[model samples]
Every structure is written in C-alpha cells, then in structure tokens.
Target: MTFLAVARLGRYTAAAEVLGLNHSTVSRRIAMLDASMGGRTLVRTAGGWEITDLGRRAMAAAESIEASLRALGEQAGGDPVQGMVRVAAPEAFTSAFLVPAVARLHRAHPGLAVELLAATQRVRQNRSGVDLEIVVGRPQVHRAYATPVCDYSLRLYATADYLARAGEPRTVDELAQHPLIYYVESSLQVDDLDRAVQRLPASPPSIRSTSVFAHVEATAAGAGIGVLPDFLAEHDQRLVAVLPDDYAHPLSYWAVVRDGPRSTAVAATLNALDEHVRSVGVG
Candidate 1:
C-alpha cells in the first residue's frame, strides 16, 4: 500500500498520510520492498520521490490486485461508506476552517477517517493523492469535477500593539508609508493575496513568507501589516483589520474531485465540507 501510494503521489509524506503511517515508516517500507526485489524501486531527488520502471510495473500489478479486492468486497456487500477520505487544501484555510469541520464530520460519521494534505502554495499540476482537493482559488485541473463551493475575502490586518505604536494607515496612500507583511512574490499560488497588493502601490514589505499562517503569526507579533484571510484572523483578539474598505480582496474556494462515480464515503465527505462552509457563513 505504501509503495503504491508513493508511486501515485510522488511524495513519501503524502503517501504516509494516505496510508495512515509516519513518513519514516513509509520510507522504511519502501526500503524493505526494494530490498525484497533486490533493486532500486524508488529514487529520491530534489523534486521528490520518483518510481523506477520496475516500480511502475509493480505499482500496476498492485493496483490491479487492489481493484479486484475492492470489487470482491463490494460484491460481498462491504460497508462502502466506512473508509478514509483524503482532503487537500491550502495551509491557512485548512487550519482555520477545514480541521474543525472535519472533526464535526467524524462526530457525525465515526466510520469515516480523514487525511488532510496542507500545501503552502498551489501548483498548476502535480501528482495529488487526495480524494478531495479544496482549492482557495481556481483549480488548474480542467477534467475534474471542480466547482466554486464558497467565496471568502482577504483584508489588511495588524496587531493592536503595532497599530498603537506605528499608527494605523487610514488609506491606501497612507498604507504605503508603513511597513507591510506579505507572501513571497515568487512562491504565491493564490491570486487573492496577489490581488490585494496589486490594488495598492508597491511598497517594501518587512516580512515575506510562503505560509499564510506564518504571515498571521508575524503580523500578530507586531511585524507589520499583513493581508490575511478573514476566517483566518477574524476571531483573533490580537489582530485588527485596517483599511477595510480599500484593502479587501475577494477570493473563491473550489472543491475538486476526480472524474468518476462518487464513492459513498467521498460524497458524504464532500457534503460535510459544503455544509460546514454554509454553516460558518464565510462566503
């Protein structure tokens, strides 16, 4: 299972999550498998894990066996809804919203297990091993069942201490004079934050991070004004919105599923996600 997962996802960490094992365990299993075959099954490179030709053949055979087993189980009337649901999302949204929502989902359906894949940025294309992918902006995949589930907005924010010390900017022009915190230009995947900065004249930022959670933390620690998602920083007592009228940027969340018949578990999980979004009124 671990070998198959690695071949599919191209990352040991992601494969580990799907297999319900630690990354080291996944690596160990792969190593053992390689030893059993007396050949290199996978190679680790700068990009990530890559399966060899032999490994690809092995993966195909494994998948065939898995499909046969699944068909047999279904014929035996196995519990279709009782299984794992892997969800992938951006880090900030996942930590702020999806985690709690998934917890509620598990409470409602204890048989369903969830594996969350939190990425710092979105890529145009990659080997994703998750069942459901909740993209903050538009997903690049055209063949999948992608839909805009909800929309959320981002706004400029600062810590109360920073505001008190530096004085809050009242307008976009004034905001240019103050230090800013934002995502690194080269690494940004979502257009929402990019749009927020584009609305204002370019200013030198005091801090730049790839992670939105890091932006929130730096802003809360009095680093500088940061453009953050409303749901991520709304309830925090330390952070306050600034230039709400001029700085808010709207962005949509999309749910992407593969092209196929929906499994009972996947459908239920997707429904739970949509329900959670509506319940929170973040849209």
Candidate 2:
C-alpha cells in the first residue's frame, strides 16, 4: 500500500499525507520494499519519483491486489463510501465550481475527504496521483475516460473607470490599440486558451499572470482589457463586457478519469461535481 501510494503520488510527503503516516515512515517502507525486491524500484527525479520498470510491474500486481481487496470489502459490506479522492483542475474552476460541489458532498458524507490541486495544464498520460482532472478543451489520453463537463465563454472585459478614461474598443481590430491583460503567453499550456489568445489582435499584453483571478482583479483595478471567463467576470459589477456578441470565445471543460474501477468515494465525488455543474450552468 505504501509503495502504491508513492508510485501514484510521486512524492513521499504526498503519499504520507494520503496514507495518514509520517514522511519518515513512508520513506522507510519504500526502502524496505526496495530491499525485498532486490533492486531499486523508484528513483528521485526533478519532477518527483520516477517509477522504474520494476516499480511498474510491482504497481500492476499491487493494483490487482487492491482491486481484489476492494471487491472483498464490498462483498462483505465492510467498505463505506469514504476516503480521499484527489483532483486536479484549473484555479478558477476550483474556486468557482468544485469548492461548492465539495461543500455539498461533505454535508452528505462527512467521512469523505478531497484534495484539490489547483493547476492549469494538460492531463498527463501517467496521471501521477490525480484520480480526476478538469481540463480546458477535450483531453487526449490513453486508457482513460474523458467526458465534457461544461462549456463556458471568455469575453473581453474592462472596468467602467478604465473605459471612461481610455474608451472601450468597439471592434476586434480596434482592440489592438488598447492594452490587454491575460495569461503569460510563454507559460500557458492549454492549447485552446493559447489559440484564443493568438486570435486576439497582436499586441503585447499590458499585464500577464498565470491566475485568471488575477486577470479579473487587474481588469477590475483598471489595468487593461482582459479576456476573462464569463462565469467569473459577468458577476463582477465593476467590469463591463467589451463587444460581447462579437468577441465571445467558447471553451469546454472536460473531466478525465483514470481508467479503472472507481471506488465508491471517487464515484460520489464525480457525481457531486456533475450535479453541481448541471444545477448552475457555467455562464
């Protein structure tokens, strides 16, 4: 179990946290497993632990055992819908959607726990430790299930004060004369978002950040016109849409689940998220 956790999470500290054990204990167990296996199974890398070929074989066997145990638990009525389910998603989605969904899940199943990894990146083929990922655009993955969760719009927005001072651009071509605020071009990983940014008039952004919240904040503070998600900016009274009909960019959010039999807890979390998205359509 310790080896499985480390292999899935790629970090001793993260494995320890999930397993409710100390870091030292997790390390010691891995060391013992390596000794018993007669060779190294994991190696530390800049990203995290890289599983060796031996580790992959060991992981396969361990997973089979885990599946068997879970089935046994279910047959005996010993397994409850409770445990940790780790998810990776965009920062804005985490704050705007998943947080509330989890809150509702907790109210019903207090024993369940969820760890949200706020990120904006493509889903990895290996997946590391994330059970589910909410990614922008449809995900291309091997041996995983990808489903569309929701579609949201991104539109140009500027503060009323900024528009008053600088005047709002009426057309996409006119937008080139005004400064723009958006994600840093160099570090943006999502192809869909990058394509949208590339379609905009070619002008260096006045401000760039990895966080969508920052874009909204900067736009709200009169920094510059920002290409922001409708779900986030539409509710802010300070911001007004710029050419809403002409400049709207539609983006879809997809949920990618690792291929396997999901535990009851993970299934419940997925269901909660789906329910929440259905209840409040992403604007």
Candidate 3:
C-alpha cells in the first residue's frame, strides 16, 4: 500500500500525509522495499514522483497478493457467499434499473446485502471503500480487474406531457427546435465523443446540468427531451422512449476493482451485482 500510494498519489509528501507518517519515513520505507528487491521503485523527475517500471510490477504483484488473500479468506471462512457489497454507480441508474436489479439479487442471494454509492461522482475502487463499480464509460482502465456487465444504451426520452405540449420530433434535425434537457458529461474520460452522445449529433447546450442523472430527473419533470441511459430511464414511469431505435449511445458497464474483493461480504455483493445485471438486462 505504501509503494502504490506514493506511485498513485504521485507525490511522496502527499503519500506521506495520507499514511500519517513523515516524509522521511515514507522515503525510508520505499528505500527499504527497493533494497529488498535491489531496484529503484520510484523515479524523480520534473513531473513528480513517478512509479518506475519496477514499481508498477510491484503494485501488480501486490494486487495479485490481495486476490490470493481473498481466496484464502474464502477458504477459511467456510461460507464464501455471505457479506455486504458496496457498489458505486450513477445516480439515475441506481434509482432506476439498479434498484430492481438489486432486489432481484436479494431474492437470489438471501445472505448478501448491497450498499449503493450512487451519484454522478466517479469513485475509484482503491480510494473509496467500494467493492465494484458499474460505470457507463471508459471501461478500459488499466491496472484493474474488470468484467463486462451490460451496455448503457442511451436514447432520447421524454415525459408524455412534454411531448404533448411540444411537438414530437421525428428527425435529428427536428430535435433542434425542441427544448432538450442537456447535462455535463464528466463521469469518465471518454475518448470517443462521436460514439458517446449518439442521441445528440453535436453539442448545442440543451439545458446544461453537471450530471446525467440530473438530466434524467429534469427530463422526467417535463423539462424537454433527454438522451439518457436505458438502465437509468427504463423504469421511470413519467419518462418514455422517444427514439430508442433511431439512435444509440451504448456504453459498457464494467465490474472493475482496484485491489479485488477484500472481504467475503464484498465478494458476495459483487456476485449479487453480477446476478442482478444479468437478470435486469437494462430493459
């Protein structure tokens, strides 16, 4: 944890602060670890204290050890499928498909309890005490164990009232005239913008919220048309599909881990989440 903390935090001082130790103590710990391995674990440069190649390998090995430890715990506990799991996901998704999905998982695994850290904020597995994450974007994050769960197929949705008041849109061009609910897209570092916001051809400021979940709520409140993830919008009684088949913003849901499941509860929770996603299918 020490080596990786410094590596990830990118500052010996910051890492030292996090560990509640002096800077020299942190340096000594790194130096000692390096002495044991006979190679430098960190490199000093203009950027900051960066993780050397050796350090990265060490971190991976450390994570592998964590996985082994969990395996050992499962073997020792005798009951490997009982515990609480904390998952971080988008708010609207949590309020919609995720709740039903979680209920389904509870039905399947009676011993497992789920805690959702739902919001627009992206919480890292290592930084946050989260077992799994159901992220809708940037599925490919190196140095983490990830499994594919579902696709957040986003489409334009609107309340029937909003559509009735404001004329229906048949074409993408026609949508420009309507008061569309727009929001900030800052959950993950999306590389492919063209494929992300498929419902919107280009950015034009529809409503301007810092959260997609907020956008969904606003859409349900008859704010206007909104391009929302199907998982987050499917169960919204007030909101209905406007043009699901016409456009698609399919983002993958990843079951990612920073260091893998630490406790039996976390493991069970992850298992329950997997089961739920399978049963729900983002319909």
Instruction: Please tell me which predicted candidate would have the highest lDDT against the true structure.
Output: 2
Q: Estimate each model's TM-score.
A: 0.71, 0.82, 0.64
Model 1 residue 274 lDDT score = 76
Candidates 2 and 3, the one with greater TM-score: 2
Q: How would the candidate models be sorted by TM-score, starting from the highest?
A: 2, 1, 3
Predicted candidate 3 versus true structure: per-residue lDDT over 228-262, tens digit per residue: 77666777798988866577666665667655554
TM-score of predicted model 1?
A: 0.71
Q: What's model 2's lDDT at 10?
A: 69
Q: Which candidate order results from sorting by lDDT in descending order?
A: 2, 1, 3
lDDT of 1: 0.76
Off by over 4 Å in 1: 1-78, 123-127
Candidate 1 residue-wise lDDT, 1-283, digit = tens: 7787786566888778766899899989988999888898887766566678778677777777767776887799775556677788888768767887888878877777888888755543545566677777777874467777788888888988898998988779998777788888888766655677887767765788887888889999998888888888888889988988777788988777754225567777777777888888877
RMSD of 1: 5.7
Per-model C-alpha RMSD: 5.7, 3.2, 5.9
Query: Is 1 or 3 the stronger prediction by lDDT?
Result: 1
Local distance difference test values of all predictions, in order: 0.76, 0.84, 0.67
